[model samples]
Each structure stands twice: as C-alpha cells, then as structure tokens.
Target: MFYLGIDVAKAKLDCYLLTQLEPLKGKAKVVTNTTKGLADLLIWLTKNHIPHDQLHVTLEATGVYHELAATQLHDAGVCVSIANPAQIKHFGQGLAVRTKTAGVDSQVLARYCAMIKPAAWTPPPPEARILKGFLARREAILQDLLREQNRQEKAESTVTPELIHQSINDSITFLNAQLKKLQSQIDDHIDRHPGLKNDLD
Candidate 1:
C-alpha cells in the first residue's frame, strides 16, 4: 500500500508518499486546497503509478480546511483517514523530530500511517456535516456580537460620535437576531437525532 500523507493548510496542501519497503521515500508536493489542486494531485499520483486502491491518504483534522480535500478524495474512491493533530504530534515526537514545517509534518504523517496503518475515515453524514457548519457560523457570529458589544460599551464611556453609536447598536441587534435563528436551527437539528441530542445534553 502507498501512503499519501497530506498536511493541510488554509491555502495549500503539502503531500508526502510512504510505502512499507521504503517508509520515508518520496518527494513532497504543494498544491492549493481546491478542486483543481485535488485533480492535479490525482494526476501526479497516477503518473507516478500509484493507483487509487493502493493509495492510503491521511491528514490531520485541520478545522474546515481539511474537509474539502478529505471529502473530495473519499468521493473519488481513495482511502482517506482524518487523523487527530495531537496523535500526529505525538508520533512526530516519537520520531525525535525537533523542527516542524509543512514538509516535515507531511513526512511524519506518512511515516505514522506506514507504521500504524490507521483505520479509514468515513465521511460524516450530511446532517452532521450541516450541523457542524451551522455551529461554526454561529460561533463566528457570537464573536462578532461580543466585539460589537465591547465597542458599544466603550462608546458609552467615551464622547463618541452619535452615528458610531447608532451603527454599533444596529449591528448588535442584527447579530442577536442571527444568533437566535441559528440557535433555533441548531435545536431543531439536534432534535432530529437522538444520539446527537443525548451527546449534546
């Protein structure tokens, strides 16, 4: 089996290949984290004679950045595993790696997969994925609300412009409405799944 370790970032993906015979043998490639990049990666792997079935891809769970690649690869019939970053970090420590970079991280991930052969990761259900997206958006809105509220409080203390105060109040009101909408949707989503509801509770 050929192990393809991908170190994902917001803009690019760094990849390294590993095999049982030569666990640390392969060149690394950097590509954008997009559909075109994923296609290019597939082409590169194909040119190198690594068939889809022989390919075992692994990457750390890097927030939502890794999701697109993971989902795309899984859809394309490639074996994919989304490993925990902490697990990968500990594995790197085991290898006595002091320096860390995208290249080095990909190498470590490749080696870890080659040695351990982690279980394949199945994509989460559509409902779960949707709920996760909602939660992330809600958190962002909440943060925005907090910042606006702080600005409002500061405006109240200082001799700020009236327009600025009005704008802040308007933003706070809009964010509050958004939060309530998100909360209702989240509650409805959780109610649809007993397991999720129980876990959340």
Candidate 2:
C-alpha cells in the first residue's frame, strides 16, 4: 500500500507519496479548490497505477481548504483522512525538521502518515459543510467590511465618496443574504438528522 500525504494551503497543495523503506516522493500541485484539480489528481493516480483502495491519503485540517478535495476523493472511493494540525505539528516537532520548504513539509507529512496510520475520515455531511462555508464566507465579508471602513476613515474628507460607501453597503447586504441562506440549509439538514440536531441543541 502507498501512503499519500497532503500539506494543504489556500491556493496550492504539497503532496507526498511514501512506500515502505523508500524515501518519500514529493510533488507541488496547484489546487484551485475546484473539481478540475481533483480530477487531475485522480488521473495522475490512475496513471501511476495506484488503486484508490491501496492509496491512503492524509491531509491536515486547515479550515475549509481541505474540504473540497476530501469530498471529491471520498466520492471517488479514495480513503481520505483529515489530521488535526496541532497533532501533526507536534509530530513534526519530534522529527527535528530544521529546514522547512514545501517539498520538505510534504515529505514530513508522508512520514507522519505512515507512522501515525490514522483512520480514514470523510468530509462532514452537507449540513456541517454548509456551516463551515457560511463561517468562512462570513469571516471574509467581515474582514472586507473592516478594511473598507478603515480606508474610508483614513481618507481625507474631500476624497471619501458616496459611491464607495454604497458599494460597501451592497456587498454587506449580499454577504448577509448568502450567510442567511447557508444557515437555513444547515438548519434543515440538522433537522433531518436527528442525532446531529440533538448534538447541536
């Protein structure tokens, strides 16, 4: 069996492949958090003759960055595990990894996967996924709003414009609407899943 480890980031992923008694092989892959990237990875795996069942993929949970890839891989019958970042960090610390680079990090991750042998963990169901999305979107919108407000406040009285204010208002309204929609979806999903609903309550 081959162990695959991923160091996930917002725009890219560092991938490592490890087989017993062999040095880890690393690849730096651009991931747009989209289906295309997932498909490309699947094709690469197929070309390498790595069966989905034989390949164990592990990635640290870096917020929503890992969600899309995990979802696609799970749907494709790949064994995917999400590791806690803190645990991975502590593990890496014990390795005495002095040099840090994307490739090095990837190799470290692969070794960690092999040593830890974490159980497969799928992406959360639709309800939790939506909630995660909403939380991320809400954070982004809040940051943008804060930045814009700060810019407006810093501007000279003569330079501040009504249009900027109007644009900010519009963006806030749109974001709020999207957040509300996501919350509603989460609520509906939780209601349907009695266990989840009880847990939430």
Candidate 2 structure, TM-score to reference: 0.69
Model 2 worst lDDT window (10 residues): 21-30
lDDT of 2 by residue, 1-201 (tens): 777778788877777667553554444454455688778888887887789888778888887788888888888988888888888778878987778776676677778777888888866777666655656676776677677666656653556688876776677677667667767766776677667765556
Clashes of each: 0, 0
lDDT of each: 0.90, 0.74
Task: Give candidate 1 misplaced runs (Cα > 4 Å).
Answer: 84-99, 187-195
TM-score list, all predictions = 0.80, 0.69
Which regions in candidate 2 have their CA more than 4 angstroms from the true location? 20-33, 134-196
Query: How many steric clashes does model 1 contain?
Result: 0
The best candidate in terms of lDDT: 1
